[model samples]
Target: MERHATSAELKARAKGQLLGKYGTIIPAILIVEIIMFAITSVITLPLDTQTMPGLIISFIIECLLQLFAGIFIAGQTYLYLNISCGGNIRVSDVFYGFTHHPDKAILIQLYQLLLMLASFVPLFLLLALWMVIDSLYMLIPITIAFCFGLVASVIISLMYSQSYFVMLDFPDFSAVQCLRFSRKIMKGSKARRFYLDVSFIPLYLLGFLTCCIGLLFVIPYMNTTYSNFYLELMSKRNGGNVQ
Candidate 1:
């Protein structure tokens, strides 16, 4: 029988998992992500003198590199989390996440990207309209963009709150099915998820304030906790049984 955990219990169990199994890998993941970011920055540097064609080429190359790196890093992180939690993982397990479930992972990534991009479209359009209507009022676009971006970010996070879990736990599920399952699992709990996300805001700000060193701890904590949360949910759905 599945064991249903209250949110508080879920959070506590996740914390325990983080402390026990995945704590050591936190620093390594941070180093890897930082190295990736650095490489991306170096490759995307603007030339001192930017001709239009040169600038365009550089921009495209930079964007492509960034996209590739982002996907690879994210996939690797998921793999690492799964393995670290005792799933018999390896270094190459990162690539395996995508390779093993190419369609579903790709779809998830694409959907996430589209949602992010779509969220900005309206703000951008409003900004353009504002520019045309009142060029002197540049603040309008800035404010609107900031507000819309904030709201959109929250929505996107909620929508994909269970994406990693879906990827790990429901490999047999199609992309659309995984998305739908995430929605169903999170149903009637958008506000609760939002609140959970909000609770992390302070840690995020603290990491920023500390020049990201704090992420060495925060990232691992969040990932492991999230994995544990997934386990808890799965256990509940599967009749209080966890493997």
Candidate 2:
């Protein structure tokens, strides 16, 4: 039987991996993620969307950029994981993902993004319905439904969170196959993964408090921990002893 590692174990292992190379590791991760942060900041800034055409054009551009970012980052995450597992580390390692099976990469990320967006559709629908109906009584139910949708989305998203790692590690797998493999491997461990993520929230909050300077360390640690977790799971699956 394959053994599953807890979040604590994975984080410790990853931290040990980075002990002698913080200077190199941290900056490499930042190089990959910086573009993502910049694009997101631009997307969120107050846009003059008073006109329909302006809104549509802006939305289209943002969507395309986001899609491009997602694909490249999926590759970068693979890069980081490989490095964490003792592959050659370089600042340019972030760009190495561009040569991966990119078409499948885009497909998987696009589907996941679309599915997440679909999850919010109910919230919007309920909000619109509440505005049209002038009843305090109906407002209560709409709000309840919206809350349920949000929770469901969280669960759904977490369940397949390992798909990116799978897609890269198993290049022969299609996007849907990668997703299915993630779902299978993650069985009964979604909450554990969620717990792993939640444990880092405080560190992230503290990092933000440091004028975002601390994120230079925090983000790489977080990303490495996640990648290590995937690696341990993969090792166990292969019946090899996890290091």
Clashing pairs in 1: 1-239, 1-240, 2-239, 2-240, 3-240
Give lDDT tens digits, candidate 2, residues 1-243. 546777788888878877766777667767656777787668756566788777877777777776776567775686567757787676766665577777777777777778767877877787777788867887777777778878877887787888888887788999899889998878877887889889999999999999988987787788888888787777776776543
Report the Cα RMSD per candidate. 4.2, 2.9
Cα miss at 184, model 2 (Å)? 1.0
RMSD of candidate 1 to the truth, in angstroms, is 4.2
Which digits, one per residue and each the tens of the lDDT, describe model 1 over residues 99-187? 66655666776676667778888777777687688866777667878788878877877877777567666677887777778777766
Error of 1 at 80 (Å): 6.2
**Candidate 1: C-alpha lDDT:** 0.65
- Leading candidate by lDDT: 2
Model 2: residue 27 alpha-carbon error in angstroms: 3.0
Candidate 1 residue runs with Cα over 4 Å from true position: 1-8, 20-24, 47-70, 73-92, 135-146
